[model samples]
Target: MKILLVDDEESLLRTVQLGWPEPDDEIVTARSFEEAKRSLLPGRAGDFDCIILDLQLPDASGTTILSEVRKRTDTPVIMLSAWGDTQFRADTLMSGADDYIMKPVGIRELHARTLKAALLHRKRSSPKPSVIAIGNCEFHVQAQLLKGETHTTKLTGAEASLLEELALANGEPVLRTDLYLKVFQREAQFGDKSLETYVSRLRRLLNEHTEDGAAAIRTIRGVGYRLVA
Candidate 1:
């Protein structure tokens, strides 16, 4: 898998380079934000599996880079920083980081987490059909864009898949287990509240285009959900 490593520290960069799995692994290291942007310019977002980012950089903050990355693609991100405070963790997660790690990290653990996060991101980001319609709402899969009535906006990869699965089932109440399996293609993992979170986020995304109606996605207690469009 292709990876982008961003850190200002040359020593840590060398360590990461030596720690990676295969000699053929496509890994790019950038010591500054400017270089990172240059690396991105030559390819599309899906060209990289994951990005290992340091929170502190010479030109920009990690959050700034992360926000910009989110704007471009849904590539999984693992924040590598010396700051391990609760607030920092919360802030990064809210800003769209997949995972957080403190600096002076073990290469093995970083490799493992990197693989796991990249796999998850890849699962969710695979392109499907375009413009799935449920009730009145429309989901544009290729563009990761959504539209209903007069409004239109983009959705994250996971959010689009979760909504698409429920929407395909029409208004039927899908079981939580089934929904998880169908959407994520695996049993629940620790803190994989991402499914439920995507449901809520997708609901909000739907609401932007909906008018004068209760939200299209209804959470059935003890069950998964139903799309009312």
Candidate 2:
């Protein structure tokens, strides 16, 4: 576990560097908002497992950094503030903070929360169906990236939902009606174009890596469709 520390207090930073849970890559320290951005960059999909960020920073507000981090990665974040304001706590959680800690916080509490955050992150980052392989393409359901051997495409929210339904079918034909009901959370009616449109989009996305082109999704005519290998 690599942890990024974004605090301006030199005394606390030094103590945390020497005393925190032993991260695999050592404690990464950032004293300002710009420095924190520098440490998190090049792969915003989390260079670290968890981040300990101070709500107060010299250059920019921690909320700005938090919003930016969420836009790019699923990394768990724990916001640190000197004040234990109720409104501040509510706002931070709404703005994508995973956990919150007030100053004069115990080291034990910090360790425990970090561990909790890590476990939660791991669970949420992976789908139950997990990695689904269809022929030569691999669909990372939770990550929302459909990967080919030499190419890749990102899945939209609707596309991922449809793919998850098809994956759960285990290559058996999943009815169009089932898809409509499961994905849209409503009863299917005739002439609903939503299901078919997403199916068409997924078919094209999967066909991007194949010799028997357009072969990953099988259309069973009057039945429905199945994910094929």
Candidate 3:
């Protein structure tokens, strides 16, 4: 399982990374609200199985991050705080946090709670749609297929995920940074053109499968791309 740990304390981040019981589980750390926002970009939130957030941060409150997380994905969130105030705990829970753990929590207990919260979330969450209709063509999300009246094209996993994000937006612009992170599963470096290459390929497929102006991806200069259908 992939987990995101958001906290400003270098010591706590180091301790969690070093003492994490499941060696195979991947853990990503963010030191501030800005860093956490980048990691939790709109289309990228589903990449993590769970998020462990510090209730207090230097830049913003943990509940602020929790609100953003709830807007994107239903992934489990466990709030960690030094404060033991009942009202604080109740507020976090009311704001969609799946669990709350007081600071100075033992590694074993933290591990157990993390697993339990994630498991419960999975059982309660609904599955995403397997197929999406894009203008005159049909996209089989799981199969990575684009089907039209006379032809069908297969797409790479990255292409399919990129398309899925755009489709989910329902024609609204999707940020370039958000697309790059969601499709590539990492932060984009300067001058990365991989996303552009995928966009060009998808445009070609769309033109060939759909009517001339039925479906298209428009570039929002200096911003991102939007699907117009």
Candidate 4:
């Protein structure tokens, strides 16, 4: 795996580079947001399997760098911060970060989380049915588009990822926790309604594009959700 490490702390960067668990993995380091942007140039952002970004940078806030990364690619980003505030963690998670870790982290734990995030990203992005039919609507997974008999709708990355999981499950019920981990790359937390929000969005889209009751997303109560085609 190719990983990008962005932090102004020279010592932490050096430690991560040397202590990376996988001997075959390549590590790229950038000390500031500008340097990170240079490394993520137009043709190069997709080269990274995962990014370990510092919450505090010398020139720009980590959120700024995160926005830049999201604009370029959906590469898994794990934010590292010394700040332990709950709001900071929530804000980053809501802003598309795959994972957030408190600073003074152990190399082994970091490596594990990093690998999990990358793996989940790969799984979400893996090839599936390019187009799925739901009633009169056709969901183009690769294109992130939904075409109905009358109108079309585009899906956000998170929405598309959620749909992919349900499509892959066919008619079977997928666990909520499993979806949270696979889709969000983190465990579900109390009061975190992101999954519900995506599901609601999909429900609305399905309702808009399909005949009444032609297709539906069923909540499995204690389990999770399933798609009824």
Note the Cα lDDT for every prediction shown: 0.77, 0.78, 0.84, 0.87
Query: Model 4: runs farther than 4 Å from truth?
Result: 130-229
* Cα RMSD, model 3: 15.4
Give the per-residue lDDT digits (tens) of candidate 1, residues 1-229.
Answer: 8899999999999988987776677888999999989766634755899999999999999999998888887888999998767666756776788888997799889998898778656655666456777446677766877877877788776677777777656467767855766567555566778677878777666666665223678888977788774
lDDT score of model 2?
0.78
The true-versus-predicted C-alpha distance at residue 47 of model 2, in Å, is: 1.9
Can you rank all candidates by lDDT, best first? Answer: 4, 3, 2, 1
For model 1, what is the error of residue 45's alpha carbon versus the real structure, in angstroms, after optimal superposition?
Answer: 3.4
Task: State in Å the error of residue 10, model 2.
Answer: 0.7
Residue 88 of model 4: what lDDT?
Answer: 64
User: 1-229 in candidate 3: lDDT tens per residue?
Assistant: 8999999999999999999999999999999999998888978999998999998899998988899899999999999998867666655676688778998999889889898767656754646678877778889988999999999999989999998878766677878966865688554667889999999989988888888623488899999999875
Quote the positional error of residue 195 for candidate 4 in Å.
9.1
Model 2, 123-214: lDDT tens digits are 54765766877877788888999888898888888898888877766677877755765577554556778877888888888778655536
Q: Enumerate residue pairs that collide in model 2.
A: none
Query: For candidate 4, what is the lDDT?
Result: 0.87
Off by over 4 Å in 1: 127-229
Q: Which residue pairs in model 1 clash with each other?
A: none
Residue 213 error, candidate 3, Å: 61
Query: What TM-score against the true fold does each predicted structure earn?
Result: 0.56, 0.55, 0.54, 0.63
Q: Model 3, residue 143: displacement in angstroms?
A: 34
**Winner of 3 and 4 under lDDT:** 4
128-179: candidate 4 lDDT, tens digit per residue: 6789988788889899998998889999988888887887777778789768
Q: Which stretches of candidate 2 lie over 4 Å from their true place?
A: 21-25, 129-229
